[model samples]
Target chain A: MYMVAFLGPNASYTHQAARDRFNQDTCVLSPQVTIEDVFQQVQSRVAKFGVVPFENSTNGSVVFTLDLFADIKSRHPDIVVCGEAYVDVHHCLLGRGAARLTDTSLSSKTDSPTSSGQATPTSKVPYPKTPAVKPVVPVKHVKKLYSHPQAWGQCRDFLSTYLKGVERQDVSSTSRAAELVAEDQSGSSAAISSAIAAEVHGLDVLARNIEDSADNKTRFFILKRTDCLEHQPMHRGAKVVDDDQNSFKSLVSFTVNHEDPGSLADSLAVFKSYKLNLTSINTRPSGLVPWNYIFFIEFKGRRENDGATGAVNAALRDLNNVAKCWRWLGSWESEL
Target chain B: MYMVAFLGPNASYTHQAARDRFNQDTCVLSPQVTIEDVFQQVQSRVAKFGVVPFENSTNGSVVFTLDLFADIKSRHPDIVVCGEAYVDVHHCLLGRGAARLTDTSLSSKTDSPTSSGQATPTSKVPYPKTPAVKPVVPVKHVKKLYSHPQAWGQCRDFLSTYLKGVERQDVSSTSRAAELVAEDQSGSSAAISSAIAAEVHGLDVLARNIEDSADNKTRFFILKRTDCLEHQPMHRGAKVVDDDQNSFKSLVSFTVNHEDPGSLADSLAVFKSYKLNLTSINTRPSGLVPWNYIFFIEFKGRRENDGATGAVNAALRDLNNVAKCWRWLGSWESEL
Candidate 1:
């Protein structure tokens, strides 16, 4: 039986993604932390496969996933690439009865016989009593804005415009924001979150598609133990059979000696000379030391591929002086 | 009187940053939107100075802020950078007394003088009297995780470890997630947000410092209309100015025509020829047709320096085809 792992409490999007990708009968494990843990679970054989988000259209790449690859590759040596999946995002507003402005009865208006025994005339204002649909006044009374960091960044333009100068708060998830707004009796606060959050928490969506850009999409990855799965070619135009195909990409993390001027250039030169396409690069300060930095890089080809495999090994050979804590992260095709 | 604009309702970090840089007497306007709007506010003379976050310690640079420089420079040619300020972030959890843990009082051990009032030994047990201290569990059970995208990204490792396989929801801000969590009475839902959010909506802190990194901070920019203020002298000391100096580094945005490989190299060569140290570089796909790309670059020197300014302009002139839109953003030194 295939065991699929995701970031969870059950109602999370990752869980939904996992369920959609795998069969319902497959056992799904919901951990309380991160995608890295899911990868670890699979590495430890606790789970057969793990699903995680790697990037989003509106927000760019998921840095943490890249960081995780950095961490894993440094420690593990055997993981390989598998597949890829793309998912569309649709945002909606859900809320309790109080937040709804349009009464359902008003939309479903139909003349019918009155319970009092008189024939109801079409002019008599249709069926169930229609509550007045009040115009949503743009009140200058908003005290706070709530949402996930990504959503906030995407809607930064809008928030700065309409809700300018309001208290902007960060939350765990959009759904949690909806929950808080729904529970609060005070109408001064609003949540900038997903429609599902509104539905779960029963909170009205005061705004829709408030993001600065509309091409919002997210990509998720399915990671397995490095030893468990071998590389397989899944991309079109590849002639390699399932047994010899390479599916996962290679990720590496290392640090350049801060004192060296050409350290970064030298490291990058290796890839360029090898004709390797570096997909992503990120730098973070080493918390333990002042002014020191660590770099994370993602390359297009996999370690199992002869060209990529040779370039990485060659780079390692030359980095005897500058590189520190190098590792190879596992590769797998994500099931979206 | 200088008027400073920021994203707000009130008590926003951006507002605080503005107030910290400019005097309290400087008229502050809260506009509820993006940094681009702040530039617009300054350009239109709605505000003399506008403040917006350009980067965070935990997150890298703010892409939108970088994108705005190109847009504003093309439309309003006069705006220039004046100063910068940095601020530290400390998030707290707050709520009403009803949401606080209940304190239990112990009986006095001393004997009373009156015979009717018998002395009782104090119990050794320290127990809370009210049930408020008990973990406020939800009703429904684990379903989803919610938070701002950045917050989620920051706390990704933790979330994946503990909440793996659960649904993940993204909101606009962390405060929104906290607000939503407060409204949820269900037993399963949880939010990864700030302590301040917990206080505002009367919610509990399920976790604290959930972010993977501890030194998380954000940087804000102070901008003025091109025609509003005179150019200030650039700070030339080896050490970068602290928050009090109100000094800032310059930001430049440009686009390289997609026709050739040497285009980007040529632009960089200009900077290198002038001995200019490039601090950072980020490239994004321009939404425009023809598959062009936008590049945001940050350098060590200020635009006010004649040699630095002349070199940049000369480079742009030499490779006219390489740069389609070249403009300098504000130069306020960051406060954090």
Candidate 2:
């Protein structure tokens, strides 16, 4: 049986992604932590493979995931990204009851049970506890909004304009927010999370399509510990069929050592020379040193099958002296 | 009196940033919402200037602020960044009481009140009325861990390793977490927040330096609706006329239409031709369109000064058709 691991709390988006990419028959492990933990799990053979979010069309790159890749590549030379998954994110407002309870004892004496009774009259402001699972909050009693940082930021305009003067809180994951609101007896707080999270936690949907952008999608990766499937096809149709199947995409990350003029031009020349179509290119601080950057590049072909692979390999080999480090992250299609 | 606005709940890092950069006696307004609110406040003449975080060394660009600039330039043409400030961020774990509490409830049903009486002889759980903060039970018992998304993310390693199975809840702001934790009588909850927040809410410090990276610092912008002062040099022998006067580093943001491949190249060439040294460059998805991007660029020169002003004007004139929009953000030195 294939062992699959994902960043989780059972029903996290990453878990959904892993299930979507890997066969349902595969044994899946959900680690309640980060993508780094997913990598570690795979590295330690706790799982054969792991799924982690790498980027979002809306939020650019997931820096932590990239950092994890860098750390893993530096320490463990065997791990490689074997598959990719693209999941469209539609954030929903999730809460347990109809309406959120506002005026939750703003006074400092709330800790005292005696004082809590005094604040209940003011704190008991009932929000309409509509049981419908609509994604949109028609009436704006949303005083506090909970979401992942990226989700919160993507919906900044809507929250600022509609939920004006309301509180916007950031959580580790959207699923966590959904869990919080679902368990919250107080109806005043709502979480901006996934529809699945809302379904799992039985949260009331306040608002739908709250994101400023409609095409909000996140990309995830399934990385293997031993580069077991490195010889897979580069561009095998859009679908995959196997016992433990996953769609594939090319993932490459490299460091540009020099910041001089035309440094980017010379680097792009390698891709251009190989006729490779780059889907995305993002530069983020290396975290290892100040001002230095790590450029993550996503493209159309897998690292093993396409002719572009040999070209890229040759280019990296030639540039490796000046380039800090370069490697293939993963190529499998992500399940979502 | 120069009026300045910033994101706040009082004593927030943004508030300290504005105070450090602007006039010592400058009238300050702490808006409870987004940086866009600050821009609107300035444009509406409610405040003469605004301060907002624009970037961080560890986190890269503050894309939300950059998006706001794009909106401000298109909708309200009056406001611009007049100065910049850089501030260090230090996160702390806080709770209520003196010594940290290790375990608060013996059973999961601590809310039942009656469950508190049915204590098992082997369990070493502290009574609910311990009066001091303690390490919450693992994820199995933890109801919630409150904190800002960034704080939670920066401390992901610690949370994953130590708190492992706990439910991580997101709050609108770290300060809000402290407020909630102060009011929560439940012993299974705690908050990761700033020391200042802990002090305000009368909570205790549970942890220190929880961030994965030690060199975390955020850069803030001091913005205004109208130009308030002309840039001047601070010579070593210059006479000090007013002790309340301030100096700031100017930040300007503009976009080059990427509809054409040469557009960005043409626009960037103007900066090169004029010999302007750009300090930073970051790109974000334009809210107006799905794939379109807006680039936020920072330079060292002051737009208020003739040399810098002339260069910017020349660049704009040369790249008029390719230029989407441009604005001066603000300038201010951050307090150490």
Highest DockQ: give the candidate number. Answer: 2
- As a whole number from 0 to 100, the lDDT of residue A170 in candidate 2 is 62
As a whole number from 0 to 100, the lDDT of residue B164 in candidate 1 is 45
TM-score of chain A of 2: 0.76
lDDT of each: 0.53, 0.59
Tell me the tens digit of each residue's lDDT in model 1 across B91-163: 4322222223232111122322321212222231123121112122211234566665666656544444444
- lDDT of model 1, residue B104: 15
lDDT for each residue of candidate 1 in A179-256, tens digit (9 for 90 to 100): 676776656667766655565565665556656555656666666666764332233434344422223345666776
* Global CA lDDT computed for model 2: 0.59
Kindly list the per-residue Cα lDDT of model 2 for residues A1-336, writing each as its tens digit: 656778887667787777676665546456648676677677777778777887677766677777776663354456688767677787776664333345434212213322121212222122322222223434333457777777866675555444545666666688888887776665667888877887788777666766766778777777786546432223224554442211334667777654453344345456544555444556666776654566666554444543544654665565465456777665554343
The most accurate candidate by lDDT is: 2
